[model samples]
Target: MDTEMYIEKDIYVECLNDIGMLEIENDEFFMSPYIRGQRVIHKVLPMHIMQTIFYYTLTLGEFNCNEESVLKTWDSRNEDRFSLEMVCKRWCSIIKASCRSLVLSLNNLEANTFRITHFTYLKKLEIINNVNNDSDYSDYDTSDDEDTKDYSNNDLYYDYFDQRKNITYRRRKRVPNKNSDKLARCLSTTIQLSLPNLSTLNLSMSNLKERHIETIKSALASNKNIKKINLDGCPIGDQGVVFLSEILESNNTIRQLDLQSCGSINGLEYLGRAISNNNTLEKLIWSYNQSNYTSVICLSNGLRNNHSQIKSLILRACDIEGWGALSLSDTLAINKSLRELDLGSNQLGDAGAIALASKINSHPSLSILDLSSNLISTEGIDKILLSIQSNKTLTNLNLSRNQLDLSIPLENLTSSLELNKNLISLNLSECDLQNFHFKQISIALQSNKKLKKLNLSKNNFTIIEPFITIIQSNKNLKSIYISKHKFKSNELFILLNHIFKLNDSIKLDNGEVVNIDIPSIVHQLEYIDLSQSHDPLTKNIILLLREFRKVNNITKIKI
Candidate 1:
């Protein structure tokens, strides 16, 4: 034992001398402790000991300060892990295995020299493409260079994968200009090369062209794990859509595809064909496109196909007029799988509303419908209410920003609301409703036990007494929006006071109610939006929120 200790001491001494720790001024490497210009404890740490220190004492591992605060520190902790990995290659390997998400900026693509394929555990990959650099990928730049050609066999266009390390290292070759197509193609190869766990690929606003789309399609063709692809705001026009259609036709793993504002009108037929051919895709958000009458008809034909299983379709701001809506309505009538349809910000007037009203009554599965910003007046509303009076499936209906206020009141709709049991949320904001309309609505909703959310904002109502009645009567009412009102502070206070004291009861010893504090009725009120109210009213609501937050589960009061 004595000989072993002597040998160990000699080895330690040799290591210290080798590392220059035995020098008089060794501040160049080792941070040796000193007192009055004299060194103390000039021992050298072995490599294993340094690794042990780095893994435990130096590494930012699981922060177990508290369970509740663990989630709050996740983002900061993740960023710190990336920075800490640069300390050594061992740390980089260890840290890369645990990283589950990565955001790579396209502007700094050339600067990313490190291999990201080491992140085998990554589930989400977001490529942040700047909108300002969209011109870099424009067709107008006719610079005939070698880089512009198809680089299927080129090493410079592809990132080499290190099979031993399970990493795809970016090449050192830097293009003279920002050729997004080349960069995008390289990224596609990288995506296909590694990241077996990647499920979501967000390439929104990437300005992807036809070739880029084709490369992406090839890369993701066999990747059955990917469930969602968001290519929103990318100008993948007709030909690009054709490539995407091919992908959709063969790929059964994808469930949601967002091609919003991708700039395609004629290619919608191809998208429609894909939609009909694909059996797995469920949700499609194709908003802000020039979907005129003929194009919409083409799209609608696909939607009504027996093979189409799309559940949610959003066509907001698609320039859809009466004829376009008529085509969609016809499709909606036959497509029983569709549950949510958003046709807001379109030119669908009363004719379109009437057309949809005729079909939605018989539709079996639709539950959420948005017809806001359409020029539908009382006649359309009357027809809709009449149609939905017996319909049992429709729950949420949005009719905001329309001309619902005419000289004649919607008496039929007001009366129909009292009998409709399926409707839960009704948004009538900016519908030009007056006190009489409010009175009728309040009276109508008195018997409604299922309606939970009600939005009556932007109508500029003078009297909120009708709404008070609503709060007093409905026990299931949870959220109410009554913003932009000409209501007094005291009136608002009374309404909120009633909401807070709702459903609570007190009884005398003999079972006789002494002072009834019952919700003027029973309720589980959660949200109230009184925004755009008087300043004093706003302040009072804030104070009220603070008070209610201390005891009740009232989540929010938007003022």
Candidate 2:
């Protein structure tokens, strides 16, 4: 069985010597007494089912599993957890005691931050003390600066054929001395002597203050099982949100709080009464804080009449208006545990979209409502599609870039998107849509069987035949975005080889025994973004998205 699924256990080399997972000083950690007593063992593949099939094939996934992090499979990754830490010292202490997360970096932490504080099966600790706004240090700082290399430049490797070029890497700015005080003394001695099964602490845009959040909320509020804390765009002020609202009112085990783009989100009325006497906060993103309208009615009067256990409230582009829409529609009719409300790109005109379309169908566990871009026309798009036409737990509705003059009440917003039917993802992107508003939303999605993801991306759109005849008359349209148009590089190079020969004549004239969920001849197009067009149609749309993504694997072509 692949030679005992590459056996290399010795009680994970005593959990990598009780924790200091060989943090250097190597001769490959003295390859453990030459395979110490290995008698070609494999008594019918036991060892905890081959160590749970070797950690399910070295997965770097499942951190809220939204896979396809821009698909860089690199030949299905799992280099057997880096060739079992280079095939030595009992497979390098069984791949360093299956370590769990450690994204540290105050740039070469004064010689391996005390052996990265002996990983002792760490849980999740991302300290990144700033590196030109680190996104995991701009995705693993890809080398090659050799003091501005010039190796007689082979014209910088032909600049990737110059047409849709993407070769960037110029990082050379390390000046962070005179006190991050050696990263707050190695984060006050690695949060007071190594991660005791730490739960998750991102510390984003890391230059976090208030004595590193009072020495990280007094060592994560005495291990109160810190659940999540991002501190995004961190330069946290208002006394770091009043010492993180007094550690979220004496930690009831924090749930998730991002505080994105925090240009000092000064006392959002002490983070809305410390999130109304918090009870395990369940997401409070507070996006791009550039607040107006009395700083969103002093943060929507601490999210009006709140009875904690908060449930998702994004607040994108926080420029909310006119009494930030009567204090966010009276805090959405007395916040009964909100269930996702984005408030996208907030310009929120038309009296803040008619004060949240007159109390948005009294939030029945509001299932995702984004009000995108917010130019909200057609007199607040007919009171936000007549309050999402009897919204029964809205399933994603983002009236995108609301320049929405949806052609002056395009049949009452296509009869409220063909009578809502509990929306299933809709985003009318840059909504000034035409061709008679795409044939009145393709005749209200012909007896609309719940919208299956649609976004009519930026409308410089020159009628791509009524969006491919409304995606060939939507039989539950899977996904669409009609990219940013302005074509003409020889008519988008003959409409990119006639849409890859019409997706190889509908996957070889629907042969291969049909049934791939035949929603109208095996419904294709699971996703398509075609980024920003005309760079000479980027090498024929990257050779028709690498030969139509090898004839199907949920067709996702985003140039």
Candidate 3:
């Protein structure tokens, strides 16, 4: 024991000498009684110990001592808390006090006795468990009276396993040992009894039942400081949504609520009402999973009242039609807080497109609008472009996969409305435009200098002459997509030569620019997409790709 003690003392002295602690000139101050006492008792005194002691002593009398100490202690405690616990008992005490956030990822957690562990000062707790794992105990049958249960209950239990076998289980069970009512009870008890200072709660990958919602409501009733709640991909029905709506109506601190991919339109209606009344919410994301047109219309009508303060609205695959678009237009025209709106993969037609375009022309705050994968035609696009010409706030617009005819006159379409200066990104892919359409687009590109990305892929554009001119003139244009369109070898080479000269990136379908000077243009090219192109160009393309690999200045090359 004496020999071991001597060895430890020698190691400690050597370490202190290495840190220049032993060669101090202010020995009287450095080796004071307070420092000596700490060194004698503490086994692992971290580097920040002196700073911690100094801050505590200097700020002893100030009222801000509590805040200062909280910050200082948190920083100091985090440094030695994890590794220092292995050193000795005194370190464990300090670490336990500082380590307030408990994160238990159930997949990695060891299986042990299920007893409630006490966390005194824990403020944030995250428990992420797999729905398929044994942790999912929601389906467990624990009723004492077995005779009272019918055969239907047994059939339901078997159906759960059968559904799992078929991979058709819609709602994932989070806790299989406890039923909805019991799980709710457990959560309520855990929140009120175990975690008192819990401010942020995120419960994902779970089949949230009605009783579980009640439990969450009961838990949130006392947690007034809870500022953010995320229930992503949870199967909470209308009743559960009502429970959350009540909570949101009373709670003012919750600034963001994400109930994405939750329940049906009924639940969404409840959420929209909650948002309508709640003024504190800054962002509400409720992207739908199924494309239900009726539900989308109902939700759009629910948001018609101008009291909603939502800034970002994402309704992907919501089966929104002309009527739904009109309803949303009415809400968005007057709503001042909304800035980003995504209505992708809906069945919006010319009327819907016109309705939305009307809102875009008037709304001062809207900056980003995505209407991709809709049934918009040339008339719809013409209306939108007219709106774009007049609107100053809209900067980004996507209109991909909307079968627009190339025969429409571009100048006449946008002649009346003033060109938008704020427009930056525009997509017009799969518009079925011929070579003549590119000339009109070229003229439009000359007028609009703010455009950065222009996509004209899957069109019947045969000539590349006008596109070459547009690329040369537009300095702000960074990306151009012109795939699935025929181009002559000489025309392709000319286009590539111009793009290389201008240092502009271009994406083209598979084709070989025969007898072209490759070495001269290789340095200027940044990105090229030639995935679908066939024949002899494939070999030359591969060789070019290899040559550019050695250059350091080239940022990206996509093939």
Query: Which of the numbered candidates is closest to the native, going by highest lDDT?
Result: 1
Model 1 stretches astray by more than 4 angstroms: 1-82, 88-91, 107-114, 130-134, 137-178, 500-521, 534-559
- Write the residue-wise lDDT of candidate 2 on 69-132 in tens digits: 3222212124554545444333334334555665656754545566654556656677666545
Tens digits of per-residue lDDT, candidate 1, 1-559, equal 1112122324544654676666545554444222211232313445565454444433344433443222211122255554344334454554455556667667444355236666767777777665354553323233447475554545445465899999874443344335666657667766666567878888884667666888778767777788889989888887888998899888988988898888887767788878878888889888987776767877898898888889998889888898888888889878989999999999989899999999988899999999999888988878777877877899999999997757766867576688888999999999888888899888887787788899999996887678777877766888988888877765665566666762243332244442335535555668888787754645555676678778776546776
lDDT of each: 0.72, 0.63, 0.61
Give the total clashing residue pairs for model 2. 1
Residue 123 displacement in candidate 2 (angstroms):
12
lDDT score, residue 439, model 1? 90
RMSD of every candidate to native, in Å, equals 12.3, 25.2, 10.6
Q: Candidates ranked by TM-score, best first? A: 1, 3, 2
Window of ten residues with lowest summed lDDT in model 3: 107-116
- Candidate 3 ranges with C-alpha deviation above 4 Å: 1-103, 106-126, 131-200, 289-306, 405-418, 457-463, 482-494, 502-531, 534-555
lDDT of 1 at 25: 52
Model 3 clash count equals: 9
Better of 1 and 2 by lDDT: 1
